[model samples]
Target: MTELSHEGERLQKVLAAAGVASRRVSEQLIAAGRVTVNGVVVTELGSRVDPLVDKVAVDGSAVQLDPDKRYVMLNKPTGVLSSMSDERGRPDLRAFTAEYPERLFNVGRLDSDTSGLLLLTNDGELAHVLAHPSFGVTKTYIATVTGTATPATMRRLEAGLELDDGPIAADRARVVGEPSRGRSIVEVTLHSGRNRIVRRMLDAVGLPVVELVRRQFGPLHLGTLGVGRTRDLTRVELGQLLTLSREPGRPRSGIGAPDAAGTAMDDDESDSE
Candidate 1:
């Protein structure tokens, strides 16, 4: 076991300050062997860690020790640009960021005419991993299209299709319900970060999107959040996202250790728009 130096803050104190728990409970968790620092379980309550450098986990979930890092989820409304600022003075995220002191930016993007989940954060590393096409984090969308999307169509989406940009396919796709009137609701999930990828994919499948809304991004979901409102991410949501942001095979250790287990909802509402 590596000895903890006295140079950094005590592990329990860091955990408590990170909103994991009260210092006393943090101490209890540490002593109970529920906490690990960089893959090694740390049972010593007095063990110290640099919040900026040392990775800490509780019960297998990565913890965010940096207090200044903010993760926000916004249910963006249609016609709002994904950018913090629009050069043409169009509706943008300034209305949302103006509510927080943090200079946050969107993790990826939502089309100006499309709406649903949008993540805004000041954590550059996380934002980069999520927004970069190479990282391949999946996003789920509920799109209202022109006609009923058959199982064959969904299979075609899953099987793959060619776009003007390149070949692409959904990680998963399905028809949400029986077609109502002239429209059908479809749910599509894909990891490509290509611009307007969802819209393009649906068009290629002969189901032009009439309305599109992203219901999920990685582990975060829109979940009954009203359109145009923003809220801070729950501890569980943050932990899951931080875990996703890490490179493959990094320790799945924890923070966000609540007094009780935290629950996150999976929103699959087809009518998210």
Candidate 2:
């Protein structure tokens, strides 16, 4: 019998962290005599191995540790649920991230009817910081509202409105473009992650939203990413996100400064429930 190393992580945890399988399933694999460490079969559940140095394998196949974490930006298309899988077989982020070997989950959610700038990651700690409201991660959205957005309506949104859950207010709200025939495009930014908060806030102020899209989250931007497409964030981009997560109070603007007409960029589009 090989002596288990006290300094290294448990074998099952290393396997699960590498995205091989869940911890329970990994234990089963070990009990079945399929797991080997440094060429020795390790059926003992308490067996530990240095992931960086150990030659871990399953059924003669070497298992490499995926030490580097992944952060992905997905331009979510409407009608796809913001989940890894669905019990009712609905389309989800998995369909787009099927090629990635890592077990990734959405950092936050976008309603099935709403879409844009959804993030997926395997880094749980970073995901938690981004999703938590205390971190003050701001999200910016451009909404197409049914009613003409006069200055009073913008004031109402910025001042605050009562919702079924609680009071919500926009960090900023301004007209994005010229209102045409009672329809106007408005840009709003806030930190609330309430379900359908954007749509509900507009409705509360008597400006029913016809469409909405998140253009920015924290320091990340959607930036012309085509709908239904996904891409990995660059090292620099990932570093910036980490830095922002550490300093929660830092302010983040949309793609650019508000133009002379006070219009923000119409980066993407979506319909809401």
- Model-by-model lDDT, in order? 0.80, 0.75
Model 2, C-alpha of 181: deviation from truth (Å): 3.7
* Candidate 2 backbone clash number: 0
Off by over 4 Å in 1: 249-273
**Candidate 1 residue-wise lDDT, 168-262, digit = tens:** 88999999989999899999998886767888899998999999989988889899999999999999999898867775743333322111111
Candidate 2 wrong stretches, greater than 4 Å: 1-67, 248-273
lDDT for model 2: 0.75
TM-score of each: 0.88, 0.66
How close to the true structure is residue 48 of candidate 2, measured as C-alpha lDDT? 88
For 165-203, candidate 2 gives per-residue lDDT tens digits of 988899999998799988999999998767688888998
TM-score quality measure for candidate 2: 0.66
